[model samples]
Target chain A: QQPVQSPQAVILREGEDAVINCSSSKALYSVHWYRQKHGEAPVFLMILLKGGEQKGHEKISASFNEKKQQSSLYLTASQLSYSGTYFCGTEGRGGADGLTFGKGTHLIIQP
Target chain B: NAGVTQTPKFRILKIGQSMTLQCTQDMNHNYMYWYRQDPGMGLKLIYYSVGAGITDKGEVPNGYNVSRSTTEDFPLRLELAAPSQTSVYFCASSGGLAGRNEQYFGPGTRLTVT
Candidate 1:
């Protein structure tokens, strides 16, 4: 099943912080985060595996909570380049080849 | 290396027509996938292959067929295309190992069926 993302659209000013949450009905083995601009392929941000591991990239970080079956992406001091749609892909036990992506969260950062 | 490449970035097909969307990867990844994205909607997997000669259906595989005859190529065939099949298709590959499964996607093909 596909994951569910909260806050369908979010508009933020530069230097603001925003949190995007993704929840899955089935237990997730790993949660993948990607960002896509208009007319472009999604770019990988980071993958959060089981055991509640948190990974960070620059001012962005994500945490995977297997017990809660959810993940959250945190963006701090957002930049203009961060303006894009963010999607969270989830993989369950039997999923190895492809991922089930959520209906992305549209984030727009204004300068 | 060109991570993952898809051919015919865009195409328009008439009803009942057929076409194939080609996907290739140079990274020698063992896992390849095909997905479709409707306007303002999340991507839904159409088909996937773990390796050459092993293909399986995904969430939405009714109007689509796939073949994996080589490690670098996985093509998706749409037979008797319908207007419902109008969407952007993406081909992706991932390195499947102990725990790494980050997928690299192609530019995507915007297909319109009239």
Candidate 2:
């Protein structure tokens, strides 16, 4: 099944903050995040492994809560370049190859 | 170096044509996947491979077939294509099922069927 993402769409002013959440019913071994611009391929953001393994790039960070089988992407001090669709891909016990992606959160930043 | 590469960035097929979407990765990754994206449906897994000689069916693999003959190549074949299959297809790869490895993606193939 497809994961659930909150805040289907969000608009923010420059320097503001926004959060995108991805939740799944199955237990996850890792959570993968990606950003996709209009008519472009999705770019890898950061991956959060189980057991408090945290990873981040620039001001974008993600945390995977093993207990809840959920992950959240935190965008701090948003930039215009952050205007895109964010998707979280979940990999679980069956193996990572069978990834189920969320619908994606459309984030728009205004300068 | 190209992490992952896909061919024919855009394609338009008739109702009953066959085509193969090719994908290659230079990173020597063993895991490869094919996904389809519709307007607001995000991405649906079509097929995936664990290694050169092993392939598995994903959620939406009815009209698609995939092969992993070599570690560097995984191609998706569409036989007797239909308009319902028209969507943006993406090819991606990851190292393995270890840790939190991210999957590298190639520029998607936008296919339109009429």
- Per-candidate local distance difference test: 0.89, 0.87
Those runs of model 2 whose alpha carbons end farther than 4 Å from true positions after fitting are A56-58
Superposed by TM-score, candidate 1 places the C-alpha of residue B85 at a distance from the truth, in angstroms, of 0.3
Q: What is the lDDT of candidate 1?
A: 0.89
Which tens-of-lDDT digit does each residue in B1-114 have in candidate 1?
988999899999999999999999999999999999998898898888889999988889999999999999999999999999999999999888313467889999999999
Worst 10 residues of 2 chain A by lDDT: A90-99
Query: Which lDDT tens digits does candidate 2 get at residues A1-111?
Result: 678999899999999989899988887778888899999988888888777776657667777788998888999999899999999888744765557889999999999
What are the per-model C-alpha RMSD values against the true structure?
1.6, 1.5
Best by TM-score: 1
What TM-score does chain A reach in every model? Answer: 0.92, 0.91
Poorest stretch of ten by lDDT in candidate 2 chain B: B95-104
Clashes of each: 0, 0
Q: Pick the candidate with the highest DockQ.
A: 2
Clashing residue pairs for model 1: none
